[model samples]
Target: MVSLICTLQDHRDDVNWCAFSPTLLATCSADKTVRIYNTQDFSEVPYSPLSGHGYGVHCCCFSACGQYLASCSTDGSTVVWSTDTGEIEAVLEHPGRNPVRVCAFSPDSSHLVSGASDGTLGLWDFRTKTLHRTGAVNDTTMVACSFTPCGQMFVTGSTYGDLRLWDLDMNQLHAEKNTHDLGVTCCCFGPKILSGSGTVQFRLASCGQDSTLKIWTVSRSNTGSCKMQLLHTLTGQSAPVLSCAFSADGQLLVSGSVDKTVTVYDASQGTLLYTLNQHERYVTACAFSPSTPLFATGSMDKTVNIWRVEDGHSGHVETATFSCEGRKLLCHSRLLVSDWSEEDVGAWLCEEGLQALVENFKANNIDGAELISLTKETLASELNIESVGLRSKVLRKVEELKAGCVCTGVPDEYLCPITRELMKDPVIAADGYSYEREAIESWIATKNRSSPMTNLPLQTTLLTPNRTLKMAIGRWRTSQ
Candidate 1:
């Protein structure tokens, strides 16, 4: 049943954010509009459109309880709306001409953190309906910000290829890990699983331009400092990851890549479990529902795709066409939304979207260690040559072996008796038995099984299944 359910189309421009209201759904689009629609009907009733930002809308998210909606704009304005009346409850404005990239509500729904092109963090208090404080950093622009599930703290990533962890309670900075060589695009939190144990706890997953997905274990000490250690690195796709999400059970991870593929991986082993290729262009966003096996994705191909993650329950519907331009796609249960694709080339960005899909256990410093070691071993096995070096050495050895450079001094036990031809596709018998083509060849070459055997070269023939290869071999042996 891998199919996508069709919903209503309300946004005229690229829809950036979609959130579930208690009974309805709200979508924000670059058309400088936010519209609320009934979940049951795709038809649009009378809806309020908040208009103030001079530029396109970037993103929108609902508060924990879905009472308030937060929207960020390319003009660097952040607005909070009352869901009941669609009135502007709070406005967050920045002086810089930079665009607002992301805004997220804390678990308590009291504070909202926003990242913008100005390289600053805006913290707003809902009670005051005003900006609480703006925190500035020396880094490049910030792209994505996320609060831990516990809401004790938050983290932000930037185009400078760095991630900053912060503690909200103490306002003290925690450990920072810099791994990607490029900007981060998106980030998601996942659960930490104990090795070899079925039960799982909580952890964080991040994606970025590095074309990698990383998992980190979040740690907090008694001093109120947070530390995130690398857990695993998942890499296979060649393009930057744009989005990622964890399944409802927290046991599966799905990632969308600019390579135009959505890959499902074993979250624990970082194994490439499945690849679903339906989008013709980059897959911008993906989300899993509260129900197991159900998921949805948005893509640049102008579609909202919904499918079941379970092995044969694919909903049968492959893709959902939106009939509009899409950039960032997200799904909450069955609700789906998409955002505009960014055009600015050099702004601070979210964590690279690829790293959020896998677990990256190595420290930033130890990265590339495995690749270096592998290269070193490959070089060491070759003979030393002044000019041609490894290439000449490898060619010379290949020629020698091809010319039957059998070693006479070596002990028979230390040698591999199977010839190259036999080892090419060797197989063991079901009866706990093994045979080598070389041994059989030697017996046939020597005309060994009978007295009528001659040294003449045996005729080789190809026959159909009615005269199987096994029968041919039997016939040859009998002729000897």
Candidate 2:
């Protein structure tokens, strides 16, 4: 089930756009400020309420590494802020000084593109903070932009109802005119790339004033030619779809609409999954977290709602649940890693492409439990494997096996009492119980000092970092 976890009401004006990094969420508004929040607990970051924009900010996006955030505004510039300290790193003035409507970072964060109200686009070299090239379309405001996964090309949508593809040099590769009856509002490229023979294919989603969301397949052949074909036209929302985003895994798609609703879809099949009606005003922006089963939607109601995808509802799978050939390997049909016999260990070694060490592992009688306990020292002293590279490879594969076991079994103690999720940063509260740091902090802030487990008042609000528990959880995670 999908549920709203929290509603952020920090913005005093309409929230124009929202973006998520690995650990932070940024929301821009017509209030002329950008706010940053900790994704862990939805608390405002200490350095939030970024006021670098001179005018109302229209859009914001995070760099690939989450190190920087770029925001564009009616000030006719895109300003880059350091995510670490919320300081302005650079200010890129859009060519022709037109109001910048949207901005995006390339897959590698090497380039930044800002679309303007005057139909002009500024391609900036992120490292140098300089304009690399400028391009424009006649009589149309450039409002939407997204970079393909390959980083070699990007797609732009305009008020003219056209979706145009361009290379890094600002040359138009293909233009799908009249993509929407009225105009395109937003567009995004899926994270995954499909390749076969001499062609590489990408999935692109565009929403427009026509009240429809369209999915298209963009293909680039070995001969360097590009083509775009419409794949699906989704009409899940009753009004104009203003924004759309693809999940990190590209398995799900979400869109915000003028009908004051948010729609989620099974992206691969273009089938509607859920229609959420929690916002009282037009939903203007939506984004998915890069590292979690969470998404955020911003609305003209001056709020941003955070939603979580429940465990089974999320279309995520453990990498270990599949064989090398991409066939499903049922965990119930095989022995757990901790219970595997010596023969099982040997077979696993072979399957991992360590056939040369199968005999060595068998000779050592390294059962599953023992395999989990193996260290570099054990490999060198006990197994007498002296090749450093091979030892490293084996250890890496073993770590992968451990990580694969996380979904099957995670220690209850390693989970936070409030969230019941594995604690990445465990801390001890005044109640003398360990919990996830952010989870407990948020709890104390909202529940008025009550201990989550004991149901009694906490004497103090102080929290101490539980280093030992954190290390233990880390090791367990590596072993899982």
Q: All models: lDDT?
A: 0.54, 0.85
The alpha-carbon RMSD values of the candidates against the true structure, listed in the order shown, are 28.6, 17.6
- Candidate 2 segments whose C-alpha is farther than 4 A from its true place: 313-480
Model 1 scores a TM of 0.58
Error of 1 at 263 (Å): 2.8
Number of clashes in every candidate structure? 44, 3
Best by TM-score: 2
lDDT of 2 by residue, 206-284 (tens): 9999999999999999998999999999999999999999999999999999999999998999998888888889999
TM-score per model over all chains: 0.58, 0.66
Q: List residue ranges in candidate 1 displaced over 4 A.
A: 7-27, 35-52, 95-97, 169-172, 191-201, 290-294, 308-480
The lowest-lDDT stretch of 10 consecutive residues in candidate 1 is 343-352
State the TM-score for model 2. 0.66
